[model samples]
Target: MNLVFLYGPPAAGKYTIGRELASLTGLALFHNHLVVDSVAAVFPFGTPAFRRLREQFWMDVFEAACAEDRSLIFTFQPEGSVAPDFADRVRQMVTKAGGTILFVYLTLSHEEQVQRVANADRGKFGKLRSVDLLQSLQADFEACERAMPPPDLTIDTGTTEPSESAHRICALMRDHGLAR
Candidate 1:
């Protein structure tokens, strides 16, 4: 179970780095937006119904991934500090995949987050929301910071290039003996 969880503020390149990480390790990428987009397509954004369905779906998928031997890299921006056993299910997943879990978090300045949100003209996910630049990105980052397992790797994405960050993540994964 090569499970690597990538979390960060919007446009902090969680998805991009997660991709590279997955590519390096041959893990599957289950990005945050995939769930949002699938649910939103049927129920549109901001609907309570959509939220329930999406959350439920993700839980099941996570569990199933754990049951099956699959290397997975998923993204999440939780609402607050993670539970003490936050990595339990993920660890199970990685074990199933014949590997271990790695937790990677990306941090950035509020100003950088706001700037990116404003310039995030390319994302379908961003265009759907009405949150002001700072609030939206900051809230998610705050949540992830609070809720995640102690990160195995944390990078200042604001100061680093995406590829560089990804490379460092790979190094962390290797150094931590997470590679199968």
Candidate 2:
């Protein structure tokens, strides 16, 4: 099994690029919003209950996927040092299942990030779609100095097409002797 973690700030194209990567590699896509949106349906976002449920669901899914020997592509938006405990949990699951992990960090220029956030067709998921909300989120993310993790691969989505980015990621995986 192989785990590919795609992480970045909001509007960085993690979902779009992860979709392309999953298509190319035939891996299961486990985007962060899957859990976030689900939990948000009940508990309000940023509440303690919401956070606990979201984290619990995410870990449970990861554990099951790893145990079943399923390759997966997961996406996240880091809030601080990529949540060391969460990363460690994933590592534990993968290790127990004899799987390897590949971390991909997507990035975009500040201007492009804002533009994408304002895109009419963009999926809001559980997030507020207003420009003011987006700006506030971006500002909060930037204020967290230790949010992002060191990545095995980094893609500038503002300058690359999703298909091309997927191709590059797949090539990198192949070079690392990973099947996908």
Tens-digit per-residue lDDT, 1-180, candidate 1: 466788766667777777787777777889887887888888966577887787777767777776675657888655432333445655655566566777788888867766666655536554323247457456555754665567888898899988788788778777877664
Candidate 2 lDDT by residue in tens digits, 1-180: 788888877888888999998888888899898888888889987788888888888888888887788889998887642344676677778877898888888888988887788776666575435678767666667654244446788899999999998988898899888863
Question: Which candidate number has the best lDDT?
Answer: 2
Clashing pairs for predicted structure model 1, backbone only: 1-94, 1-97, 1-98, 1-99, 80-147, 81-146, 81-147, 82-147
Off by over 4 Å in 1: 44-47, 80-99, 126-133, 136-144
Residue 155 error, candidate 1, Å: 0.3
lDDT (Cα) of model 2: 0.79
Best by TM-score: 2
